[model samples]
Target: MNDRESKSKILWTLFKSMFMLSACTFGGGFVIVSLMKKKFVEELNWIEEEEMLDITAITQSSPGPLPVNASVIIGYRMCGITGSIVAVLGTIIPPMVIISIISLFYTEFRTNKYIAIALQVMRAGVAAVIFDVVIKLAQNVLKTKRALYISMMIVAFIATYLFGVSAMLIILVCLGIGIIDLIINLKRIERSAE
Candidate 1:
């Protein structure tokens, strides 16, 4: 196919993939992230695994919803602003449609025993999915074998889970540290090249 045609096809594919993933996904952004890693990283080989992890970290640290942040990044990477809009629309539309439909049945659905039971079951499933995400992400971080990072992760987990320390605080501190590390590394490289 011609360049324009090929690009169009790829955009369409990205749109369709995001739409389908959003439609079927029940948990939330983390689940969508895992699936995206599987699809774009493992299956399609469109992005590297480390890059996907970086994308996930960036999306999570940002202010917006994870899926939206992810869509924006992925789409921009693939095509540009047009692709980003298409991707965000695809990621959002499914939930909007589902919510619209559910709103029509709000009263009945609220009173439905089966739905309550199903929701309880779904809570367990969601927990499992979240746990899986945690494990995978932790493993990825731990693999780098940086004692400082490993210690920080452990301390951060303890602070958040046990002591109720604010996550935003942790993220901000880590962000500062990362910047410092980058600056130091660059200076070291320059010194070595002298």
Candidate 2:
């Protein structure tokens, strides 16, 4: 196949994958992230698990919706600017359509006893999924076995959970520490090379 044909195939696959994931996913971005990891990292072998972890961190830290941010990064990684656009379109379309329909029936949906029950039940499942994501993320961080990273993770959790510290503040502090660590590691490498 020609280069254009291959690229087109990939783009089509990317769109379909994102659309399906977005449509089926519930419990927000963290839930979809697990599904994305399974699909992209485990199933497709498109990206490594480590890359997915990095993507999760980056997406969580950046502004706006997590899934959209993730799609832009993942799409750009796969197929540049065009891929990002396609991915965002796929990710947003299902939710947009669903929300539009839901809004149309807002009063009926809000008042329906059966619908209310269903939504309440769904909250339990959503909580479980979010918990699972948290565990997986924590495990990934622990797997590195880096003292500083492990310490930072623990401290950040403590600060947020116990002290009610701002999550944004913790993220900023971590980001600064990460930058300093990177520079220090680079300098060490240069010194060793000399």
Each model's TM-score?
A: 0.95, 0.95
Please identify model 1 stretches exceeding 4 Å from their true place: none
Which candidate number would show the highest TM-score if scored against the true structure? Answer: 1
Q: What is every candidate's alpha-carbon RMSD to the true fold?
A: 1.2, 1.3
lDDT of 2 by residue, 32-115 (tens): 888888889999999999999999999999998889999999899999999999999999999999999999999999999999
Q: For each candidate in the order shown, give its overall lDDT on alpha carbons.
A: 0.90, 0.93
Write candidate 1's Cα lDDT for 36-95 as tens digits: 888888887878989999999899899988999999999888889988998899999999
Which stretches of candidate 2 lie above 4 Å from their native place? Answer: none
Q: Model 2: C-alpha RMSD to truth?
A: 1.3
